[model samples]
Target: MAITSANQLELLQTAEAVAREKMIDPELVIEAMEESLARAAKSRYGTEMDIRVSIDRKTGRATFTRIRTVVADEELENYQAELTVEQAKQYLSDPKIGDEIRDEVPPVEMGRIAAQSAKQVILQKVREAERDRQYEEFKDRAGTIINGVVKREEYGNVIVDIGRGEGILRRNEKIGRESYRNGDRIRCYIKDVRREARGPQIFLSRTAPEFMAELFKMEVPEIYDGIIEIKAVARDPGSRAKIAVVSYDGSIDPVGACVGMRGSRVQAVVNELQGEKIDIIPWNEDVPTFLVNALQPAEVSKVVLDEEAERIEVVVPDEQLSLAIGRRGQNVRLASQLTGLDIDIMTEEEESARRQKEFEERTQLFMDTLDLDEFFAQLLVAEGFTNLEEVAYVEVDELLVIDGVDEDTAAELQARARDHIDEMNRKALERAKELGVEQSLIDFEGLTPQMIEALAEDGVKTLEDFATCADWELAGGWTTVNGERVKDDGVLEKFDVSLGEAQDMVMTARIQLGWVDPAELESDEEAEDEDAVDTEEAGA
Candidate 1:
């Protein structure tokens, strides 16, 4: 069928209709149509020509042209697309080397295969444009909530038709007890909007903690208006949840505002979550106070924090321990998540017993190691002396504070503590030597006697063996043990040497073995070169 003037007008009208339906620029659709027509035109005019088609937007006039570039003789890379300056003179009076020559070709009739190819091209372009538009619309909307109808279910995942686009709510991201049917109205958090090979993928989630936060934002007017801010949220999804909120204004109570008048606001959120129980706690900057609030309805007797270890030990009354821990440890677990700390909940009795046991063990250790009787050991333990290192390192005045310890006695105790440590080190060094530890390794500056013994036991018995060890093997690097990387299982962990000290020892050994002393290596190379030069001069 010949592409007449009426066909050109029909093509323009069809492009405009499809562009409106797909919500894409009409100009882009026209470009796609022109390219499709150009592809069909290639069958009439040989495919060797650089064929192109352009359609007027307003008049709907279609023009097909073959393009050729005039180039210098040496610049003609493709014979079909380029012509030498001299060869181009036949078609024109004067031709510049970089000028382009376009020849108009008459529009021809299209065969069945050619028309089908044009339709496919148009459809592909429309699909791509639709995907690009969706990506641009939703990419910045990530982390926001949107409502959509459940379009279909695929392999346990719900496909939601969020107006103008579709989103997937995977099975794991759905609430455990909640079920969705087709055409059900659902709201979800836009977890991600990704441009994939097939199209734009919008991933939705209902179980994310952010989803809970967003729901609260919707229900709580103060939260949305920035009067009250949600500090943290942790959810068990359709079971229970904890949210911490703080108010910038002292007059506004954040918890009360979020709970709404007579619990209407929070109830709205719970209804959306399929009756997920939410505990709204007031946020506190103090960690212990925050943790107490996080474990709501469970009275906490005390909270002991270990800041360095990022752990907390909570002491609840014996009657309240079960409540503090909740059913199957859910309360404590959610509290930990809310506060970003590891929580260990125990009864007051259990904590007291544990402290007593630790005290007895420390008292025994001091009595046995320092050769002190029970009275003196108990006095030291009572004064907060836990390890021998502290006893050896403390000033004489510290011991003088203990009863029955005069200046001279304190001095004697210090001497004895020092002497005991020196003796232990001497014995460890002798044993390490007996175990075949090299003299160089033993003499290394940073290697303690205990570290040397550890190395000898691990078959690192010589200076050469020590020098050949990797930094991670000696010091502690992450190593896969039972399919997980362990950081504390380094070879030096059993010894007194720290990871930094282990690394230093390895470098010192390498230097001692002359393996990597750059200054010395350069000097040696220079000396050898000078000697060779002298020898050559003498021979000449």
Candidate 2:
């Protein structure tokens, strides 16, 4: 192969033909050709020469040149490619370091070996361009649904020809044991698109919760038009799924719109999911109310939500326990996922028993701490006095509401409660001191004596130690590991220290220690507020 006038137009014609077949830009193919020609020119000229090639877009004519850069005498390592500025006076009027000097070179007449090498170079460039094009086309398509043809099955993974590229559907990402044959048309969620050394990998998933939501988007006009938004979705692959939706329009019911007329829209999605049962529920801002809706078909006797723990306890009728928990706890698990909360479903009988046990425990506590008889403790528990703090610090009028409790009796109860609490605090403080707690930590306001004792037990003895602690470490929190929530115990968790209060106290300690600037914090907070307002305005 040689660059001749007769074949100049042929080069461009071949480039356009290859570009059309690969669905890539013709200029990329031309660039690849120019590079291949340059390699051939390097072989024809001295292999050490700095050969370059440029092709005219209109004329398809190839031009070859050798570039020698002028450099400092000490820096000129390549004799064929570089020359010192003092040695290049004859070729240029003035020369400087980093300046390139070019000279035209005759095009190469590539032999069989060189032609094969050039062909390989062009193919490599074309393949790279193809991969880049595929990545660019599919990267933003992630989190969307794509239609493709099943090209082949490699091991347990299915490879689909998705228009310009291939996508992989891993066996675990498939719904149930769904299998596909060659030439089968498939619809899947574009989970991810990544550029790899080999090529761009397009990962598709049929079992993703978003897949179901997308199917609904396609089937439900209201969902596609954003009249109804899918708030959350939880799926057990081909078994069962739940979708929570909210409607922006007051006239529209999100659930009804998703269900469509006579269950047509939902039926379409269900059929696509291989008969997966779906429960469409309306979205609610109230977590308890939303959970009640998410549980579906089972009546909840009561919902006890622990916002701090991100947990909810649902009490159902004895008969509804199995239904609420479903087969192998699937119902409650799905409800938990849909509401982003850990759920504990129990029968009403169990709840009653648990409440009785708690009441007995509180009654015993009051009896022991206040030196009260069983009847008096029972009276205190019945009046919602669970801890000594309430009896100690609450208004006397509130304690007087209890049956057979006069003002003098209330005063006496308060006095007993206060004495017991003071004694307990003294004991806790003494224990903390014994554990080597410092006065700085004790003097830090907001921490109760019991809290300080707990911190000391946990090896946080000084204010410095407390300041270094994370808010979550002091207030306890839930951590999600491998899709399950794990509880992290905190030193002050038993003392009823909230995360916000712990954060404030920690920041206060940091400011006191000169570790943080309060003015800087205030400015940062103001900047954040301004950014939020700007975002709201832009959104509007």
Candidate 3:
């Protein structure tokens, strides 16, 4: 326990044993032991004095030293840790200011408290070293499959004993209806390795689609050898999964290779996944074709795509609708995920009926609103004038192409469309007022009557709500509309104001309420000038 000659060698031996056990560099262990011994020595050698200790790596011997800096009397910050010029000359004849001088300090007998303190320091160092080791070992292993034994369960979560460290498999990351017992061997995807205050936390996942893909890679040599590539994977966890694979070699069948002889390869993956059904399909560059493949056994009668909206309408035979949608919409959902497209499945009968209804509605809309005869309204509908907005916003030339519509008539139609929209806005403003929306927000320069209604409907009825709303929320940024992607452009589409004007209006509201500092809006001219000068100088 004491720093006696007999125990000095024992310290180095202990450090080596610890280093071996912890899988750390022996030199690191020796450094930790030296620091611990130095801390203990400080108690006897005057805590204010700079005392340090070193353990010879090869000889297993320890040395204690006291460090002092040679400083002029006027320059000295601490008398206990510094030596004056003349005093330092006693040890070093030519000692210079700011030069360090180290003298051998006699080894002190380690006291019981000092010994305990040393042990604590060594333990803290070892624990830190172990954490670094664990982090290093697993950080790059993220997304790879790891084999471990179930160590314990806490609150329905399983702790796995990975060889070098432990991994936590959260309840949500485990396959549904799957259970693990202590000491049972399991394979899991290393979802993440995070360094937390407690220690390094290696998170494991069994339900991740990557876990299944990795299982396939291990089972199929072609996938691992780069002959076959798994393009995309989607899973509903313990129920169903879809994988799209592509073959680099035209000769090799990727799906066949992944399925293996007699379904052995895919079946092995399914077994690990608690019998999660796997659909191995060929990856196609064409999105619609890929969607059809991802849907598998469902027969697609026709496919209609809306590129701007990024939605696909797939029509199947009446008998195949249930099959295409799968149980609880799982099949279509997985296919959507795999293809990165929103899929709308409908029976051929339903699709035809829906198209007819849309055409009739559009025809009626044009006839009633534009004062057009049934034939002309049908012509407008066929020309893609679905709503009054299209007619109002469309180019003059677009209406001229419609038969029986001259420039004069087109202008009249446009005027009527504007009048209709203005009426709608007037009604919307009235509705907003009835909903108790403040008149101040209704009259706001940047917001249209429609935007006001949208805000009031969402309970943003006051000036404070208007001021506090985020720009995205107020502007109605990008939104997924009926599985179709579209940008609402906030109030920009409804009002003539730009996005900047809308933002300024919000800021004005905040300023009126004194919610924000006005100084932040002021440009820092002096700072800008200095930055310009710096940039000029750097360029020169």
- Candidate 1: give the clashing pairs: none
Q: Which candidate is the best by TM-score?
A: 2
Deviation of model 2 at 96, angstroms: 6.7
The TM-score values for the models, in the order shown, are 0.86, 0.93, 0.75
User: What 10-residue stretch in candidate 1 is worst by lDDT?
Assistant: 483-492
Query: What are the per-residue Cα lDDT tens digits for candidate 1 across 187-220?
Result: 9999999999999999999999999999999888
Candidate 1, residue 443: the lDDT equals 79
The local lDDT score (0 to 100) that residue 149 gets in candidate 2 is: 99
Tens-digit lDDT track for model 2 on 1-540?
788999999999999999999999999999999988888888888789999999999998999989999999988799999999988888888987888889998888999999999899999999999999999999999999999999999999999999989999999999875889999999999999999999999999999999998999999988899899999999999999999999999999888888889999999999999999999999999999999999998899999999989899999999999999998989999999999899988898999999999999999998888888999899989888779998999999998888899999989989998888899899999999999999999999998899999999999999999999999999999999998999998778888889999999999999999999999999999999999999999999
Which candidate, 1 or 3, would have the higher TM-score against the true structure? Answer: 1
Ranking by TM-score: 2, 1, 3
Reference-based TM-score, model 1: 0.86
10 residues in a row with least lDDT, candidate 3: 490-499
Clash pairs (backbone) in predicted model 3: 475-490
